[model samples]
Target: MAHQLPETTSAPTLFTHSHPQGIDPSNPHELSASLYNEDLAPTTRKGRTWNSYSIFTLWANDVHSLGNYAFAIGLFALGMSGWQILAALGIGAILLFALLNLSGFMGEKTGVPFPVMSRIAFGINGAQIPALLRGAVAIAWFGIQTFLASQVLSVMVIALAPGAASLQQTSFLGLDTLGWICFVTLWALQLVIVSYGMEMIRKYEAFAGPVILVTFLALAIWMLFESGFNVSMTTGESRSGLDMWVGIFGAAALWVSIYGTFVLNFCDFTRGASSKKAIVRGNFFGIPLNMLFFGAIVVVLTGTQFSINGAVISSPSDVVEAIPNTLLLVLASGALLILTIAVNLMANFVAPTYALTNLFPKKLNFRTAALISGVIGLVILPWNLYNSPEIINYFLGGLGALLGPLFGIIMADYWIVRRARINVMDLYRTNPEGTYYFTRGVNFRAVAALVISSVVALLLAFVPALHVVGPFAWFLGSGAGAIVYLLMAKRRIDLADIDGEAIAVTPKH
Candidate 1:
């Protein structure tokens, strides 16, 4: 088969010779240095080292997060019994498992990350739109997560130097002076870990995941014992029948919403999977099972907090701080800090690294982009963004509405519109002749789909009536985007014309 890349004016990346999946050498399509880099290119077989356990650890790190644990605790405060909350979580976990499998399939089979996988749908140059959007979201969240992790550090510092508690009285940019020191401290720590790249991240995650699981599980057990093994299930008035089902689905949707941003770029990790079965096994154990068990732990801790303290404390830090024993407090604080770093690196760090690198492949490799992102994360003053409702709701929330449509359009183009067929070489090359290089390397059809779907999705955010289904905004928006894209694609890739043979174009593993 002929490599379809254009003749480059300058030298292609070193990836041309080093990686088998790079530009072909003989009768080679030398990928342009402007759009091609080793970091963004498909991984070679030797590079795919993540096993089933690696994948499991990935989610374990993500699920055990302080934010996620807090969200789980809030579910019980809504009058739902323990069983009801568990059912809702189960439904949401399965939905995440299913969506991740769908989003990850293309990357796993192709050994390509999310940004490159997007080239098939968004066109090469036009792919920059989603890349920029994803990069912005990732950077913003990265800063916010770092700010959160810093708070955990604050707890540890005071546990050691009790005098550090005085630092809270003085404030700057919504954080105290010592908070700044701790923020940068944790920031530097995460920067060191992220700088080592994905292989190192995978290894650290394997260790962090199991440790976080043990620590949090132990915290829950201790809390259970402190509360005399008495846990309350109901905090508010109970409802059954259709109302109960509504609550269950609503809670399920909310639980799944926590993953809304992460899922769009999930291919970044799944692309390194050692086997298809590994991803399946990992997703099964990591998502529904892990979510269920972790959520159960959160429920136990929160219920016991209510029993012991006679108050509902949802924040993990608050719950931990309330622990009377200094020894347990120190250990739990350290565990929370580890999980925060694990989740931040896996979720917040990796996406922006790839997205930013994709925009300027010649000037920016993974490390350079990562450094740039980390620096920007510090300068953004993310504490303000987290504290301000107007900015959070309008600015970030508005931009976030696109995540679903971006994901929807990609899924639609890959599965529904194109029916899984793709021209792989075309994804890397910038030539007008390449299959994906539509209309100056931009797909107006996909753009139109995004604008239309985003508008539909945003209605749920603004409209009072639609707010009832706001928990499902991502799901609803994805459906809207997919339907629109499929409709638009009928002219370009006729369903009846390319139904049978098109599947062979993008080679299978």
Candidate 2:
């Protein structure tokens, strides 16, 4: 009954790889064929493909994006000084580091994606809830990011001819004529990239990280030279005095909220890592320092542009498009396309693809699920949803509200309740008697915790009186759920004869 464990997985010698009971990939760990697919299975030792560099590039590519540039400088409108903005970035970095590491642990230790990991906490059948929720949230994010990327192209479109700027006057479905065209154009480009699979996405990410970094730096330098290096911090419509300090902290919470979608599905990426060390090393380089430097540069660019234009510019595309040179505009358009696609693939596309596959594993595969997800992007009206800084935070904060409780339950169940051990085989087993087969194959305690915490969390974000508290929706949901789950589950989780990544892969049944 021995089960193999991943290299970084903490387990006893009783479950060593040299056990007489070797896993049979032919039968494929005897997982219920219904719950198992190539995409849903625990990564085999050799199948663990990503390295530290892969992790580095994944975060680097996402951080250096059009939405993020807008996100970083967006705090300026809330009346924060450069130093206060840096403080917000610092707070966000620490919060995000903990969030990614904790959320990614079960994935690293077991090499199972988020849906499978959910079975550990929510019971086999109940796992579908979070998967569906994450899928919906991801589709919304896909559209939002696509819309942001389209800004760069929209700028290009308007500059192509004098008549193009008039397209803004004609609105359809909340977006102007040029906006709709650019949104669909970038939307098509990202689908092409996502259709190619993870390898091509990886290549795109490696290229994008450097292009955005170099391009943004060059743009920043140009802006600095234009304004004689006089960098201002607060924007035109900033809050005054003590109110400004309050808004700064509130805006800082957005940094964590922005990551709400991926936090629930961090496992989707870490499941492919060679080891936890590789992921940690990559995250260390990719997140905190990268955000600090990249955010600072973008903030400076925004400040310089404001000083020159005498107005606030949220998106970087406008600044890049100000130049009348057709060739530079073309080059910048290509770079933004790369940046947007890279982020969409890694952040928005990958997680939902797995979520959808997990839902209909028997009838669906990766590409089919991905194509459906891409189409979902086309229908979403992101132009209206993501109108301003406050709006984006509110949008993501609501997502964090639901995902936060899920995060709490999953982390608490895995680390505290199960002591970081999971029965990987049972996760896929359809039998009612499986280890994870709580009452009717659904953990009511977890469901109760999710409902209660989500209600309180949602109220915090949506209520007019608690607007200041809304930014901490993720924290509130996570803490409330963790507390409730621990109180409700009285049976001590005995860590005996647990399974890990002893399973391997084969074609689905």
Candidate 3:
């Protein structure tokens, strides 16, 4: 007989079955004390409070960062015209929106973070491996973003006070005294805000989103008037016809790859959403529309820079510093600093906190996990990583390869293997007989699939001769993993047994 969860204020809202007797309350496999902890369980209704606007603000905080701004500038360097770049961005944005919604749906319904949801496919213990991988990636990102924000702060400080240049004369760990001061200050500020918890982070994003939008708009308008109307979208030698179309597609792939990491872990945000409709609606407005608006601003600002300076200037700080008006420069720099802080906290800080918490729930809560992640971020010395192209390529490429398979495996298990009928309670089960406990708390099939796909994708990315497949690395890895897992586990998985039914799952010894 199946087991019924005890009715409690903290119990999640489960979908009712036609026959109430289908659930058995006498089974030993039904519940485990070690598994049903509050931190890893489905989020309580009280915690599911984020509305459409909050979700929108989350994406806004993610997209309006220095890295994204720089990436937008880099797209023009791909030999595409302004119109072509815009088209590519639009297409990529739509694809990303759909992907995020698909990934978010499970979290919305189950009210569990990505790491907890991962248990369904990877087994309870196996989930920790992916969680750690994701947490490590988030830490690297946190470090890089922190360094980027600090650079913006440092620039603003030097711009406002000329005397600050003296501080740059002394160097430590490859960064000057002024750089260290700004980095530590920004890093500590993010830690403090995150320590207050998720609600405070949401509030920060909500306020920062509009300010960032206005700041970019103001900068774009200023550049337009300053640079005159003779702006040309074509920078350098531009391709047209078939060549331009190819470039557009390439640009689109690049755009999609930028959010590859977030695509895998977006459920961390959506789990807090009030409803599925809220997440879908928020993603629509936040992703494609926001990207379109930001792309237009970037194009105009970049075109104006080319027209005035006879060269492309993608760095907002550099652009601001070039302004002859000191007051305007200072104001713009301050706005950029605020934008950076918002992005760093929303995009880089929160996900890892949850990931680390999931890893060791009893010992590490969200605040402690965040503090640990922050310490590792400093150890990575991201300022150096940001400057070194070879290191950045290897690190990001390796991460993409790793994350792609994980995305594929989870989506395949949920949508195909389980046919969207996840036994939410089973996700937390620690019993050897639990459906998710494939073999000693690990799913070897999924791990094998992840390894095989990641190896192929990494080879494509790093091998000089196989460079032709480099652009499609994310798709290749994800598709390979999904197909492999489906083929291997098709007969072993029993979907009908998921909905309030008890089935003996023999452990593979």
lDDT of each: 0.79, 0.75, 0.76
- Residues 20-53 of candidate 1: C-alpha lDDT, one tens digit per residue: 4654553255456666666766665555878889
Q: lDDT score, residue 447, model 1? A: 92
- Mind giving the per-residue lDDT tens digits that candidate 2 earns over 54-127? 87788888877777777777676655667777877877887888788887766777878888888888888899
lDDT by residue (171-197, candidate 3, tens digit) is 989999999999999889988988877
Clashes of each: 0, 0, 2
**Best by the TM-score measure:** 1
Off by over 4 Å in 3: 1-37, 492-509
Candidate 3 RMSD to the real structure: 5.9
TM-score of each: 0.90, 0.85, 0.89
For model 3 the TM-score comes to 0.89
lDDT of 3: 0.76
lDDT of 1: 0.79
